[model samples]
Target: MNKWRNLAILTAGVTMLAACTNNPYTGESEAGKSGIYGGIGAVTGAVIGAATSSKKDRGKGALIGAAVGGAAGGGYGYYVDKQEAQLRQRLVGTGVQVQRNGDQLTLIMPGNITFATNSSDISSSFYPTLNSLVTVFKEFDKSGINIVGHTDSTGSLALNQNLSNARAQSVASYLSSNGVAGNRISAYGAGPNQPIASNATEQGRAQNRRVEITLQQMQ
Candidate 1:
């Protein structure tokens, strides 16, 4: 299934590139086509990390994708299924939680394992685990990834936002340096605005202080 999806992407990209060889590119100029393909690339990106996202957020991601008319041709779900399976297999016993929704997958790394108290620095203990994950990502290059930072309400709103942003940047930077293309991965900080637990309790706060990385299916 991966081979098929990879082939499809390669074929489309090659065809688009070959179009430049034709004479009289007035109606099909490189500039126009490049813009369209770039839009499709955006769709490819948004499709990642949106499956487990909130409905509103997922909708926004889809809008970014649909506006460019980018799609993975057909059988996109199957391609994603294979990739998700591979990811789950690789992440076994890594202290990372893998969640799936439709053809998208999210990697939830709790703050306990991902970072220190009020720090954005990724722990050295987490390096080996991330290396394993990056090995899979390098193989499955078609998917787009989004890294989101979340925090509990223990700090000021401004501080929480900054912390969240920095944490997200840390993860995204790590992934980029490890092999994920910079263009296909994005980072966003939700701060305290999008908490999954009550801020009144230690347990809830622990759960809220986490990072989520979503991978969209290839298109």
Candidate 2:
């Protein structure tokens, strides 16, 4: 399955490159459609250029970078899966739902689990879950993780966005203090922009308030 996904991504990259004729802004036309893996010439050019940092070898860097980036992305995905499996048990009682899709892991935390009305602080009851999550972060390899805070449409858009952002930052800070690298994590507050359910009802409002943790590629 992993192999197939990689192949599919590669094919898409190729097709995308092929369809591009020129960069409108730069007025530069790429020499090859499949910029990274189409041939040995492209590879050689990319490598030499990247290694030497010279115009003659620009192609080499491009080729090497592409190959490295793709492999790294795939390898990181595999690693995330392994880590998620190990952390799944620890996360079970956190009032948070975990969803895994291929190389991605999403941790959905209900508002009641983490904060008070229109606030960003992680509630006392949330300590166990937050602490457990931090422990998991400490054990896992460092990677780019996004902490996204969301809210139901209960207030002004500006207020919601700020609160959401603050919540995400709080979560990020907790993890960072617990051993996760600060630089590897990003906080985002998308107040009411993305809700799992409508805010028309109490249940839906509860559903809309959440924190989303997205594990990105490792450095």
Q: Which candidate ranks first by TM-score, i.e. highest?
A: 1
- For model 2, the stretches where C-alpha displacement exceeds 4 angstroms are 1-74
Model 1 RMSD vs true structure: 17.5
lDDT of 1: 0.72
lDDT accuracy of residue 78 in candidate 1: 40
Task: Return the TM-score for each candidate structure.
Answer: 0.65, 0.64
Candidate 1 vs. true structure, TM-score = 0.65
User: Taking the tens digit of each residue's C-alpha lDDT, what string does model 2 give over 14-109?
Assistant: 434533444323578744222323333333333443555555544445556545544443344446646776667778666788786655778898
lDDT of model number 2:
0.70
Backbone Cα, N, C clashes tallied per candidate: 1, 8
Per-residue error for 162 in candidate 1, Å, reads 0.7
lDDT of 1 by residue, 107-172 (tens): 999989989999999999999888887888888888898899999999699999999999999998
Off by over 4 Å in 1: 1-74
Against the reference, the lDDT scores of all candidates come to: 0.72, 0.70
